[model samples]
Target: MGSLLSVFSGLFGSKERRILILGLDGAGKTTILYRLQVSEVVTTIP
Candidate 1:
């Protein structure tokens, strides 16, 4: 976890990677979050 955090921190100024999907209130923010956590993506802000 610490190393992962460092990787995110290291991307401080690099080009960002973003994926945006829109849906209603009960859509699936939780599901997306779960996938991201499991995938160990370095950073995501939204």
Candidate 2:
């Protein structure tokens, strides 16, 4: 519930790698989330 960038960086920095993707209906939330998940997973694997 704060700066998403800060949270993301913190998680990434700590190797926690938690992700939260959210958006309202008709906002392409699911699609974006799916892509983001794939990207994150890909990036995280080295």
Candidate 3:
């Protein structure tokens, strides 16, 4: 929600932010996103 967005905004010092995650196939990109969302690690299958 608003608070979560604010945390990210504060980290990057911006009111608006765009993020892109680039990696090879099966390189755990989904895993990284999952970690960010939940603040924990989980297995991801491409």
Q: Best candidate, lDDT-wise?
A: 3
- Per residue, candidate 1 scores C-alpha lDDT tens digits across 1-46 of 9999988888885677787778886566756776776964334444
Give one digit per residue, the lDDT tens place, for model 2 in 1-46.
5798888888678565556767675666566665766764221221
Query: Cα lDDT of model 3 overall?
Result: 0.84
Off by over 4 Å in 2: 1-12, 15-22, 40-46
Ranking by TM-score: 3, 1, 2
C-alpha lDDT of all candidate models, in order: 0.70, 0.60, 0.84
Candidate 2's C-alpha lDDT? Answer: 0.60
- Model 2, poorest ten-residue lDDT window? 37-46
Candidate 2, residue 42: the lDDT equals 24
Evaluated at residue 8, the lDDT of candidate 3 is 89
Residue 39 lDDT, candidate 3, scale 0-100: 93
lDDT for position 3 in model 1: 94
Error of 2 at 19 (Å): 6.1
Candidate 1 runs further than 4 Å off: 1-15, 39-46
**Residue-level lDDT tens digits of model 3 in 1-46:** 9999988878888466668999899888888888888999997654
